[model samples]
Target: MQFKPVVALVGRPNVGKSTLFNRLTRSRNALVADYSGLTRDRHYGEGRVGTYPFLVIDTGGFEPVVKSGILKEMARQTEQAIAESDVVIFLVDARAGVNAHDHEIATMLRRAGPKIILAVNKAEGMNKVQATAEFHELGLGEPVPISSAHGDGVADLIENALASLVNPVVESSEETSMTEMDEEALEQALATEEGEEVSQELFTDHRIKLAIVGRPNVGKSTLINTLIGEQRVIAFDMPGTTRDAIEIEFEQGDKKYTIIDTAGLRKRGKVFESIEKFSVIKTLQAIEACNVVVLVLDAQSEISEQDAHIAGFILESGRALVVAINKWDGLDQDKRDWIIREFERKMRFLSFAKIHYISALKGQGVKALLKSVNEAHAAAFRKLATPKLTRELRAAVEQQPPPRKGIFRPKMRYAHQGGQNPPLVIIHGNALDAINDSYKRYLESRFRKVFKLEGTPMRIEFKSSTNPYKDSEK
Candidate 1:
């Protein structure tokens, strides 16, 4: 399959690379801030310039690292992104003018073998423009003066950049003729599994879409890497290492799964100060799309309010969940038990989910995790027969009668499993919303018990239905 072009953004610290990223992509996908080193890893987002679709990579701003450490790691990631890009948007702070570090980064970019576009950012007014003149000394080309914050001179830069691409654009009629041809090509590509011939469609028929979610630095990327047995997603020691929701598809023991590594969720109050707010939105989107969610938790840290909030989203979304206590290698037995018990008690709504202790760094417990995932996926799609469902409904009704408000007795007529894959059960009833929380919990408990659906989330929709003729006669 043909892939889109990649554009990498590189600049000195606090030079507005992130800001320029947000402007170019027309998305706040990258974290932007006033401080230096806010972005510590390479964040990828899709961008379209005119009709040219390209992948925009927002790299951490360069910090002149004299020695090997996290800063060196950050620089390496930036260099890697620049190396892979089709075009590099080399940003320079118009306000700061040309500095020693700017020169250093420009020298590196010149050797990277990508088409480099010089963007002099923070050029808000005349003084900024006058200051941008010093950037000519870097010797790449003419600096495209732009104010990423104010959205100035961006469109012209993109238009110019796309015009320089190597590919020739086909005419509209030619493109339309190629549509049927492309479908046949795509079908052929899908028939082969990465160069191996497959008789049946491995992933096309049945696939598990799972999202790995947790707070920052909870080893979400590491878990994905372990599951896929490769470095599909970049992992680092720093918090918020992952800034984009990256989807990768792979098969394990013949079961195909699509794993999405999401950005960590921070407290909404704290997010105002942190630049990773965009990442949080991406995580929420991932949660909404996935069939099952694997909530990764740092085994060392106490369960915080942010963790609970993230769990609440999964519960409300009504997706099958698996709580992965990551970093289990370092934890003592006592600590491990305490954390498991606490997580269970605090996240009572998610108590049905199975908890597994795993060390994504060491590749421990990943096999069992995958097995549980397969089971949960099957349970999510498990269909109950009408007779069986009615029996369970009777048991539930007998255990706890619907709430009585003074004189009236609430009645539930019938219930049926309407669908599978997050297994929705529709209950036809009278004054459904009036059913108390306690009775709702009882019904949920009874459903779980009858089905033995240990780690799957079940939905009970209360549909208040009555005879249409009776209402019309009234």
Candidate 2:
């Protein structure tokens, strides 16, 4: 799986960690409450700052004097979060000032040695800002004052925290060396790997892998039919009709693509049949294998839990996601707008995905959908030249300087394009772990806007000066 950077919010009870998490993630996935210890389990959500996306983890709050089993479990979960996180947000309540519990948490965070950002929550008005000075006594550096409820300073706090974790010198090139093989040779190799009789003629020179995924009966099959202009895959109103993934080859604008139609996925307990069990696993495997995923959603149905589950899988797998709202023929403009807005709001984690409204049965937006697919495919393989990347890096740094964690100012030495096919770029820098998410997002957004990687998911590999070995060398 692709490794997205992970940030964990750690603090004592009732310090608005969950509130901040919801704000950063732009989702209500985490349960927020006034009561302490309500969040007993760890919650994971996708967080985005500009175009740079990362996983945001919300752990149960810490309580120093508690000895109950539940509190002990919460502590264990917090410790695990610290260990797994790439950066830690040491949140404190500015309204409450620096208390004994805040001091204790700061000590533990220092011991953990992860990149730390002290966030002072509930600092809203001028008086609260003055009170925020008290948090300086915690000794975790100048606190970023924020109000989780009113959405003030949270963005700046997150931007500052994440900016410290990015490495600007990473190379931006496809690590996979292009093997100059003829169509016959490439097909033969792939067939041999699969241990099956596959057609060499089916493989094309510039083939793109696109997987159709969604809840059952979202017209995935219908959309595929519209794309290929053939009823290659069966389309029916019956749910779970597609029991296995079927790959079809087609050419679009001189480029070839393998379109995969997968079985409709349901919740685990709802999926009982053996065929369905196998189909779910196969669909997940296809998602991992494909370069881009077209998530089909029913325009008529409200965005269901199953849709979110499928989207989550695609995002977590680190594949480029495109949303196709099928069966948009009868809907009015207002309805379409409402659906689009609500869908975007609910699946905010999939904000990276481009949305298309289509009437698969009527062929209304099929052409535009295909064009988007082509653009997304091309974007997926985009690579940046070293000079251009370095220029952009310099510009980004000059615009907004990296956050200083101590006396040392982290310097990004160099960057190079390492690979494509989901473009990978690596940077060499000082204290690479301290490069925060905001700066990383700024750099990524700048890179995407300049390079015009409109619909692809690109990864930035942050490497310190000590680790210079490329995968090719290994």
What TM-score would each prediction reach against the true structure? 0.52, 0.52
lDDT of 1 by residue, 85-145 (tens): 6688888888677889988887887766678899998888756448567888999888888
Q: For residues 1-474, what per-residue lDDT tens digits would candidate 2 score against the true structure?
A: 223456889998899988888888888553221122323666666675434545677888787557778887677667766765778998888777778888888888888788898888888885755857888888888778778888887766666666655432243334533223444654344344342232112223567888887766778777777777742433233233222345667766567777765654343212323234223334555676688888888998888765776677676666776789988889888888889888978888775668898888888887888777777766766546554565567688888878887887777755556666566667656787888888787778887787777776777877665545655584
Cα distance off (Å), candidate 1, residue 78: 25
Error of 2 at 172 (Å): 14
RMSD of each: 14.1, 16.6
Per-residue lDDT for 272 in model 2?
A: 27
lDDT of 1 at 35: 26
What's the lDDT for candidate 1? Answer: 0.69
- Give the CA lDDT, 0 to 100, for residue 247 in model 1: 62
Off by over 4 Å in 1: 1-205, 230-245, 263-278, 431-434, 467-474
